[model samples]
Target: MASTWRTRKADQKTNLAKRRSPNIAEVSIPTHFRCPISLELMKDPVTVSTGITYDRQSIETWLDMGNTTCPVTNQDLEVEDLIPNHSIRRMIQDWCVANHSYGIERIPTPKIPVTPAQASEILSGIAAASRRGETTKCRELAVKVKAFAKESERNRRCFMSHGAGRALAASFSAFAAGPLENSKTGVLEDILSALVFMHPLDEETAWHIGSPESLDSIVLILKCGDLAGRLGAVLVVKELVSANGEWVEVMANTKGLIEALVKLIKEPIFPQATKASLVATYYMVNSDVERMASRFVDLGLVPVLLEILVDSEKSMCEKALAVLSGLLSCEEGREKAYEHALTMPVLVKKMFRVSDMATEFVVSALWKLCKNYNEEEAEEGGRRGESLVEALQVGAFQKLLLLLQVGCSGSAKEKATDLLKLLNGYRGRAECIDTMDFKGLKRPF
Candidate 1:
């Protein structure tokens, strides 16, 4: 039956291919006409509005050489204009013929039904099954779990059930350290990431009792050797260190965490995993944003930040923006560092990307980074003080001005206005530090 169907399909395509070009699309190839590297269509097409074109052979050569210059106009295609090769042209034609012959579109691929909760449940079940030497059962469950966990945690409130949440995490850890220790199967990183990093346990959730003290668990989990475990551990540590740490103290203790964090950042497995680690390191270190700025600069974190900023796939730019904020806070040669930051246009471009500039912590950071260098200056102070003033002045005053004049409906705008007053001079800066508003701000942007 299959062979007969394929033969009929071949006959149908032969009929279509033999027929004259359909009225669906038209072409009038000229002397200098060629296929666009982008559309790959042959026509008397006008050169792009950008005013660039090339010859027929030139177009083919460019299409062959991956040159994005317009065939007739000779203008180079922009980063945004460069189109991918026509990958599915043949497949599309086959579909057209097959559809005209078969009279039905292809059935959609069956979606694998798996939630994060379900994924975690499977991992837990695997550990339970593996412990009793149930290899077959473990393999069966693993087979059903798809290549990746796509579902996000549905409710932040779910993790508020501190007892169940902690117990579930502990149990997952136990499984990894116990029977699964020797199993050649993959370590349970996805499961753990879903458990720890997902919605249930954010800062406001406040269900877990592990503030600062539970730091060891994350380290242990990372050491246990699973991507989920490592990420989970990193999340836990990040949450813990941040439960409370002054910037100076985080930077003061930076040495102890650097080696461990560097090891995590260098890991090749997951870019998100490495990014989370470096960002956490960038976050965990306590310093006047100035004090630790040079170390990260010396360690060559600037270029890595630019790389993450341009990658739009992951939300990694948030962290990269943060590291930029911290770098802006540095006083010593801050302009040079700012110059280096301009290398990637994305970071500067994306600063005002948030909805509420006043309340969005990164916005304030961007505010500081974007300002006129002198008026926002704080060079008279120590490295830390200078960095802080730089942060306040870096376009923050302008954002604050906009906030004050235009105003925001949210309370964060009021808070930002309040924070802005502090930047006006030492007295206001002292007032900002002396006031209570600064406490909740340490972790956000």
Candidate 2:
């Protein structure tokens, strides 16, 4: 069936070419002057092992999409090699120039494709630099690797298949552990940025590079490195947590990882770094490790998150709110959040201030506090009542009522309704409740 289809296509192309040439007096380009695959003028013409010439992109698309037979010949391709049809390409260029009055533009020469061998040689050089602690050489080679990989899909696959990804990762791990005095921290950061750009690399290679020692090195970069380095390290850590399955827990337990992340959150040199730190922290806290979640609270992350919320743009606000929501899932997290002076007001102020997502996170967090803190716990000397009283005193009940009146999301409205009920049940005719005025309730959304 496939052979017959290819034959039909070839015949159709031939017929089209014949039809196009008959009107040449009207500036009609001969169909044979175009690639059969694209039905357009060819650029970067190359012939396959099947003796059929095609535009390089069109043929590459054919093979990349899993077709092994030649489009024009209907013959099984003997090899995957593409030999540049320079003679034919030059002819196309000359014809275009001759037809310049007809609005034809000559095709410029295409860049020489990087061979797998060239990419492999660069990888080998990077590995050697790793062994010799040659930071400058490693940075230069790392740049070359990134350049080649960015040149073409074929170059990227070549690097992946020929072990360039693994080699580069190994080199990163080595330099990450080397003496900081020997190499400028910027060099190490460049190597890491190279890895971040070549993501979804081999899973085994990812694991080999994301070892405990390497993770510690990355965390160190997060703590004291330059802004770009900090941003790159966060991305690298995000990738490791995603690719390395159970290795996430390993990273969560890495000695200084959490503390470094918290510090980054508190004093992010760049906005992207703060966002990435929030993501990295989200991953670790989402690991569902009890001790890990508590440690975030212990490190005073809640208040830092609170501070971040004050000036955060919508996206960052959402993430900070989410982390707060997650932290509130446990007793320690709740205690920390309720204890913070700005927690209630910030949550209230951001209720309708940011996006729907931010509102949802805020509502969910407040609901967690209201629903979970019980009277029995209050009788036992818990701060549940105190927190609730604080919520009520700060017009939390009024905000809940306003949320429902001014129209929030279905989920937010439901949570608001429940919170109003919870607060009303706890304190009848609460002092703050008398101040509620439905006429004044208004929101941008």
Candidate 3:
């Protein structure tokens, strides 16, 4: 441990130097001086079988995590053995001594990591506790595991190696299997929080959590839990879907699951939750199934997305536009979009307001609605003509002309040109016209 005064003196001097120079790259730290795991000065350097050196503590933690491959080399480790790199440690110590005036403190030797036998014993204990339905001990173990995992990348692997992730998953299963009493909610929360750190979860672990009961629990959290719980559920769902989307599709297709996700977007939650929901929804909908599109419409997804498009930040607007475009491609989706008052105007208005991505998506949405228009109803000036008429009334034609004249992407210009030609027939124009002002238009044909 560093002495208080010494640590304070070092920090104060460092701060003073930063205040003086701001860009302190003039006195650069050597690359070899830093540990790959912590990116700090390495006190106890050690070499793995892959011939790459890392801090002893970091490599040990990594091995303890159950990772059989070297983090730096990505090669399979011959064994979990790590040799002390005494020469590199001495070099770091000497450099620190030489730079003493610059507030550099020599790094102290790191402590030994827990042995394999000891790690196995801890995991066995947790597993046994889980089997006995000891929720309190399970929660405590999860908290400790998450704490360790958060300390460094190496620690995460180490914690996972000890079957902590499986134990946490089991704890969740146990908690979810029982009644969701207020007292047990905290334990569930702790377990979920721990699971968040073990991202890109393996297929087996994902299979365990992607069960119907577990998915229902996650959806319930999205509905009733706090921000952290909702965010955790969203991330966990994303991971599960990514690991095995077909498995998640079965859960995502359920009305309750779809409704909960749509409701999440309508809620005044932060954009992270909303963004995650969008991605999960996109992944679930990325199939040739018609029900996916209809499900979004049945749950009133268009209007919710319209609201999101209006006030959402730029990135959110892009995602909302993409999902909206996908939904509009289906016949039912087009009908649902036409039902909304702001859908046409918002789609047209966003054509030039956001980025190129937004522009392309908005135009695609318009093209879909136009391509799917009922010819008989359009000729009769019925409900099918409402969207086309609204597009004209809202100056969408003017925007498309402007995009083509001012130079847009090939795809955008292509779709815009096709839409312009299609609209000309509806307006009784004899030939294509480059018109902007929507007011003074007679049957120029």
Candidate 4:
């Protein structure tokens, strides 16, 4: 009996192997199942008005590239007239299943893109929920909208076209204006999560969120919400400032907003948040707007930026130096930078070590600090500040010389040349000589 059972099991294993061992090349795919444009099997086949079927993605690409005719028929085609060929799609699935032994995997059903009408209906529901103080209902609808945005690029474009950005902004504004409660935090997070998908916000929507109430809400989130929420808030600020330059002033004026942004850099929660905060801060201060620069300086943005330059990666270092350079334009900014212990050393350390843009910014900042360091002051019995001496102490003189030799931008080279001339006055000072490391060589003095 045992021998007979073993023979039966062996026969079953042989049958299974035979079923799984079809040569893929021997099985020919039907030509009709292939997309005329892609020349591959159709996954989501749709028929155009010209009575020709093509893969949906391929046809969409064709139309998006400004072609009004079908690829195969060369007939006038309207994108809206493309209809899903359900029968053909079902047949394709069946064929894949039959060809399972040839390593053919069945394509899953494609998600239907959200129509403008559907997006409008969802936004209306969210608005009604907000009006009735229905936080739970609002959260539910917001999650649904977020899912649609995440489903595909087409759905996100639909949502943006149908005022989803404005509606979400209004919901967030209401939440910010409402009482702060633990139960409502989920609603805020959901709204922010959805809003994040609505990038490149339209001008009106950007202005809508740039309001004082909405700005305050963002600040509140940065202070209290979780990491995702804080990140979303900072990203929104970045988008807003980018979309409209006027919003930068409004953001700069918002109470605690600058402080909150600076704090994110000081004690970073995540890299995205830190970088976004840096970009936002750079925009706000990168103007002749002395008030904005002063605000950043007063909030101690300079030291935090110098600290970032010490250990941050290349991109982060670039942004930090950009913001620091902008801040140095103001009197208070220059004074604050002069006070920091790490300012001179950090600036010199980043010169040739980072990219050219970073080197340029470093050179510009050093020029700003030391351009006024007059040799005439020392000759007139007046004191020369420690900034120039500190520059030499940290090997700024050597770095600048190397920077000029290797070549740099026109502006950067000019600034570096001027910096070399200024620091030359302090090269032989006894204090600089004592603090500077000469390695194995004698002092130039």
Question: TM-score of every model?
Answer: 0.40, 0.67, 0.68, 0.77
Q: Model 1 reaches what TM-score against the true structure?
A: 0.40
By TM-score, highest first, what's the ranking? 4, 3, 2, 1
In Å, residue 428's CA in model 3 sits off its true spot by 7.6
Q: In order, what lDDT does every prediction score?
A: 0.46, 0.77, 0.74, 0.84
lDDT of 3 at 107: 77
- Model 2, stretches more than 4 Å misplaced? 1-62, 69-113, 150-154, 176-180, 184-187, 201-203, 310-314, 340-363, 376-445
lDDT of 4 by residue, 326-414 (tens): 98888888887877777777788788777988989999999888777776665674323677777787788888899888999999899
Q: How do the residues 1-445 of candidate 3 rate in per-residue lDDT, one tens digit apiece?
A: 5699899999999999777644433456789878888787777898887778887767666776788888887898743568778889889888877766666777775544544565566667667766787778877776776676776665666667766667667667767775667766766777788889887677666766776667778778878887878887887886776567576567655447777778877784878888878877776666555578788777888888887886678999998988888887677888777777777667877887789999999888898888756678877876558778777767777788888888878888888998898776666422233333323432212
Tens-place lDDT digits, model 2, residues 1-445: 9999999999999998776554435776667568889987898888888777888888888887888889888887633478999898888989989886665778998877778778778888989988998888999988877777777777777777778768877887787664555355767777777676677767766765687667777877888887767887888776776665576688877888888888878877778778777877777776756577888888888878887887778989988998888777777888877677677767877887888788888898999887887878766757776777767866787777877877877888888888888788766534563322323433222
Q: Which ten residues in a row have the lowest lDDT in candidate 4?
A: 435-444
Find the candidate with the highest TM-score and give its number: 4
Off by over 4 Å in 4: 1-47, 51-55, 82-110, 178-184, 288-290, 339-341, 376-385, 393-410, 425-445
Please report the TM-score between candidate 4 and the true structure: 0.77
- Report residue 158 deviation for candidate 2 (angstroms): 3.0
